[model samples]
Target: MRFGVAFLGAAMMAGSGIAHAALPAGFTVTIEDAGVKSASGAYFGGDINNYGVETFDSLSTGVHSTYASTFGGSPISGTYSNLNVHKADQYGGAGGNNNYAVAGISQTGSYAIDFTTENGESLTYFGYWLSALDPGNVLEFYKKDGSGGFNLLGTFNPTDVIAKVGNNASGTNPYYGNPDGTFVGQNKDEPYAFVNFFNETTGFDRIVFKQTVASAGYESDNHTVGWWKSQGGNEVPGVPEPATWAMLIAGFGMIGGAMRSRKRISVSLA
Candidate 1:
């Protein structure tokens, strides 16, 4: 890929402190379990997860994406040129009930950062703007401790905001093409979510997101969300354990003492 030399330089300068860290090297945002009913096309809901190694580049030139639904399957990856990002507040139809082929840039390719604390812990912090959605659409946060379970941080519902809507408007549902000649649901606008994380003490490696399907029907509610990672970013520093640091410090101290004594003896002999 083509990278601007100046930008890369700036990225390194900003991320110099963590150059030797063992933290994540990048970040990824993904939507999971996202879809509405294939028949009624009512309310839609799914999970959005932004996980991956923490990096400085992600905070600078990361990418955000929303894919057309494939019904109940994973989002199909697309070419970089084919990816489109839009503002979230530009969509969401009239009264917050619509479905059409929607896509846009959420956060304008900005930074969503995660970091490791001094205690050898990891935390994620992200920020972004969005529009177009029902008055009740919500985004929930979660974290995994390398265990089999997930912890819910909280829920962020877009109030007085906008969101992207997916519909089968033109009858050409790329995700779920109609058997006859008419699509059921079409995605409308693009909604973006920016996330931030911190307090990475346990060094966990997974994150999950879930959207609540409120009162809207099963088909055309709050669903259809996906994300892609922007390559390269700042790396979180890996702080050695207290014991490890102590050992290294002690070893260095011994070496320093030996060198000083040798210099004194050599001077006396001369």
Candidate 2:
């Protein structure tokens, strides 16, 4: 078989150059300020290599919004670019949880979001670009109520995201993989980021995510936040059942009783 030196060189150059694109274009993103209301922190983790950033070209598909907050709600729109996305990996002797380590970008601390939807309802999904697969970790989603209350929506295992990144391949020095539960340093299989219920009816907006840490001999803890936009308006799915209202009223009654008892105790003490 005849080998072409020129073709080899060209291929190498192309592969090398794939990662060196300019930062993402300008965007005026909204992020909430601290002390307003926030759920958990969002993390954006990734690493840059000789080839360039380990980004999935399809990662930013569809219309999505990003936000940041300390407690929850209180959102603000801001700008996000390729430069600001967090990317981290194991380097040097620093080793704790290989999969335990995750890079995070926040909509908080000057973070928020805005997105568009054509239909009456819009769906927001969550994910990230996996430089490597970490089955030990899971992605959690939280939803915030109007008065700054939070509820855990669901948790996603790496298995759910495996399909999206399977075809993605990385040309960088280090590689990342998209295989279900496989972690390789340089695969371009970027995972999707989302919140299952950010529709108009919910009247709820904003989202955040963090990486889970688990290792046999070592334990790791990490958190991060991501932002999303609401279709905007007073609408959502699923009606609150009569039982739901009963529970809510009963809960309030309990609180009221507690308050009255506290007052009586204060008087007795005086």
Best by lDDT: 1
The local lDDT score (0 to 100) that residue 19 gets in candidate 2 is: 26
Task: State the C-alpha lDDT per candidate.
Answer: 0.25, 0.24
lDDT of 1 by residue, 32-106 (tens): 112212111111112223322211111112133322222233322111111222111123221233322212122
Cα lDDT tens digits for candidate 2, 180-201: 2222231222222221222223
Q: Model 2, clash count?
A: 65
Clashes (backbone N, CA, C under 3 Å), per candidate, total 71, 65
RMSD of each: 25.5, 23.7
